[model samples]
Target: MDNRFEVAVSAGTMRSDSSAAVRFPHRWTPGGVTVEADFTGAHLLHLAAAGCVLNDIYREAESLGIDVSGVRVTAAGGFDTTTWQSTGIDYSVEVSSDASADKLAHLLEVVDQVAEIPQAIRAGASVRRASSC
Candidate 1:
């Protein structure tokens, strides 16, 4: 079976200028709640990391037969204006479960090694801009 997946979101800027407003079609929470997308690029990047970790935790917990009641992951980072790159990307995960501390720690470590967004960032994926007039 093919386990690979591709996730996509569509966004655009109102203008080509430096002050152009970025817009997204919509935002959806894991609980199936939809909200307007009014966040910056930095905010979205952090969110992606957090979301990936949370999802992976659930997956791993399920495979380990661990019942997880709740999970929260917080990711924080900043972009250096001079270098135009991200820095200090850090995160914390809080999980509510009945599993032992050692099991939980092991699960977290495994997920951190395999989660997609953080891996991509760590690998320094090349980004290229395409424009049409």
Candidate 2:
């Protein structure tokens, strides 16, 4: 197996009798988690990073024989409007596990080096518009 996958999401605005809101549909997740339509582009970017890290923590922990009970990752950053580019991102990970501190730390360190989303961002992936409708 290639061990690689792609995800697609669609975003748009919806209007009801009371107000208009943004909607983002993530098809890859169970029930397709949706958030309030008020988030900025930067917020979504950071959210993807956080989600990837959290997922990877559990994956790596299981592979390393560490029993993880919980995991949380927070990713936050802002973009410069003038440049329309991300300024920087900061993330913190917290995990509840039965493993020793040293083992947990080692697992996190390995995940930090391998998590896909952050690595792609750090490597400066190119973005090009595919179509307009």
Candidate 3:
């Protein structure tokens, strides 16, 4: 199996020489948090993975009668300074839950299994444009 997939993206704005108008599936505003990222271009990929994992955890926790109000997933990636190549990503998953230790661990395992974006990234799958006009 190739283990690869591709997708096409079309934007309404024309190619800009200096600036570009990017779009994201969801928009979030940080009221007082220091971390604020405008999901555009490559940043969207990171957001997708983090969001998927977070959603999975939240839903699973809810099913187990655990509240996930203050849960946060801090996803960070490192790039090689010389080559400017992406090295790897670190996931800092923090949650305030009342579930048992084993239940929480099980929930995390399920999160790993159901989160599609993170699974693709973990498998080292390449993302590229299928076609462009």
- What order do candidates take by TM-score, descending? 2, 1, 3
Q: Between candidates 1 and 3, which one is better according to TM-score?
A: 1
Model 2 TM-score, all chains together: 0.70
Best by lDDT: 2
Q: What order do you get sorting by lDDT, best first?
A: 2, 1, 3
Taking the tens digit of each residue's C-alpha lDDT, what string does model 2 give over 1-133?
A: 1111112121112111223423333332232222322355666787777667766776788799987665546666666666766777777767777799999999999999999999999999778999999
Q: Write down the lDDT of every candidate, Cα atoms only.
A: 0.61, 0.62, 0.54
TM-score of every prediction relative to native: 0.70, 0.70, 0.60
lDDT of 3 by residue, 1-133 (tens): 1111111121112111223433333222122112233554345555566667666776677676765444456666655555645566556566665677777788888887878888787788766999999
Which residue pairs show backbone clashes in model 1? none
Off by over 4 Å in 2: 1-38
Give the 10-residue window scoring lowest on summed lDDT in candidate 3.
Answer: 1-10
Clash count, one per candidate = 0, 0, 0
